[model samples]
Target: MTKKLFYNDAYQTSFDTQVVKNDKDEEGRDYVVLEETAFYPTGGGQPFDEGTLNEIRVDNVEEVDGEVRHYVAEPLDASTVNGVVDWARRFDHMQQHSGQHILSAIMQDEFGMATLSFHLGAEIVSIDLDATDLTEETLEKAEERVNEVIRDNRPIETKWMTVDESNQYPLRKKLAVDEAVRLVVIPDVDYNGCGGTHPRSTGEVQMIKLLGWSRQKKIVRLEFVCGNRVLEQLGNKHKVLNGIKGLMKRPEEALEQEVSSFIKESKQKDKQLAEQMAQLLEYEARDLASTAGEAAGVPVIERVYENRTIKTLQDLGKKIVEQTPSGIVVLVSEQKDQLQYVLAQGANCSGNMKEAAEKVMPLIEAKGGGKPNFVQGGGTKAIAADAFAERLREAALETVE
Candidate 1:
């Protein structure tokens, strides 16, 4: 087993070590096992420490069999090398891990909830609780309690004890390992077995901010952040709020009212605009019907549009029939990739528009349905829009007879 120096000094950033063996993973990736290492391997729901070995970037660390292998950017040529851990990343992990321990302890103690699993993400940390349901009041209370413990600045100590000696203190969970059992103790607050690195005291955690929680599978996954992450999130949110305030031309205090008023005004304007467009479409329908061409001794209105919607076509067709009580309406819309057409007629017209559409449907490979005087459909452009209009004109005239 490689000697893990992090267990002795969690704050150690640099260390002198000798490469015991240069090994490779099953995928032929280069890794080196040092006689003693300060890099923390990936385990205990905590990520591995990233740093440099002999100034070669250490990408990952993991325990294989009994050796802690450090996967490197390039295989080390020197037997005697210096390892430097990235302090910012290591400290951030420390703060988050310690915060998780404190939060989990409080949830188990005060709320009677057990943390089933924990995951430290790139921007946030999440813990899956045993219970599927979590309410706002319960979440708020838990958040308050954890921050209280963080503010207390209590000492966080660890003990290396045998199985018999571990039985003396109250442990939160059962021991996973029988030999070399390491227990992390928060004085009288919590005593749990953990191999992950952490800060010396709860105060170093700074603060823990709970984001939210939701039911995931059969458990509740609660998300949160700690220490510098809290500051990062606050800075991002402040920037977004400032941008919104500037766009709205409102101060911070009045921003909410300004946004609400803007939304109400926008909705009213939208309603007015819709009403105006409807009136304009009605007028257009009447004008088109009045100037329609005659076919089979009856009026036939034919118009082709580019990129118009089926709903608009239907509305215009309805209005045209309402205005001209004895005219047939044939509307074709050419979209970017497909062709759409509507066949409709006035009440007094004897034209079977459905029959006309049925003849056109097979030509365009289209699907449609309607009554004897109304039918609408669209499909891929099997034929050009102009040719389709001519075919529809001939079909409409035949149906008029």
Candidate 2:
């Protein structure tokens, strides 16, 4: 196994280690394995460390079998090289991982809640706890306890022990492995077996902020941020609040009430507009019914509109047929590059409107279905609107014959 330097000193930013293996994988990606490395591989819910190995950027790090491979863009020329860890990223992970430990421990100690799983994301960290519901009071209490522990500046220590030696400390959770257990301990507070890197003291986590929690079945997943991330989140929220205030031309205190009032007024205007539109459509339908031509002793109305919606054509067809009980209404609308059509017959009409729709639909390769009295469909505008309407009238007359 490669010597894990990060486990010894999480603060180590640079180290000198000889390249044990330099090779290119099947995909032609260059990778090097160092005899000892301060770079932490991606595992235990914490992401891998990124930096330069012999000045070549290390894009990814993974442990396969027993070796830690540093995937790089270019292969190193020298066998002996310096490895530098990206301190900013490494420290950020340290803060998040350590903060999770304290928060998880306090949650269990105070509420008997067990952390089922943990995830360290780019902007946030979350822990899945085994609880049905997490109330606001419970969350605030746990957060208060966690911050108090951080303020105490409690020392965090790591101990490597055999499977038998691990039983001595009061572990918060059971160890997954039977041998070679490494315990991270905050004395008299928390003890858990973890492979992820963490800070030397609880204070290094800076501050742990529980952003929110969501329910997942019987568990509650708590989202949080630590250290520099907390300040970043606050800055972003403040920026958004200021933008909203400017847009509304109101102070932050009055923005909520102003937005609520605006929404109510807008909804009222929309309702009034809908009522006026219904009245206009009713008048238009009567005009079409009166002007319909005779088709085999039955009234027929055929017309094509521009830029109208399929729903509008449907509504007009329904209204015209209802007004003229012995009539057939065939309305088409050209919207964008397609032609939409609707066919409807009055309650007293003897013709099958479905047959008329079937005949005209195939002219434009359309698809639709309806009862014998009403049908609707749309397809490519292969024929002109006037020509299409003429064909539809002929089809309806044929149904009458």
Clashes of each: 0, 0
TM-score of 1: 0.71
Off by over 4 Å in 1: 264-401
Record all residue pairs in model 2 with backbone atoms less than 3 Å apart, i.e. clashing.
none
- Candidate 1 structure quality by residue, lDDT tens digits, 55-85: 9999999998999999999878888889999
Please provide, for model 2 over 150-199, each residue's C-alpha lDDT reduced to its tens digit, 9 standing for 90 to 100. Answer: 98999999989986798887888778898799899998889999888989
Q: What's the lDDT of the predicted structure labeled candidate 2?
A: 0.90
- C-alpha lDDT values of all predictions: 0.91, 0.90
Q: Cα deviation of 272 in candidate 2 (Å)?
A: 4.3
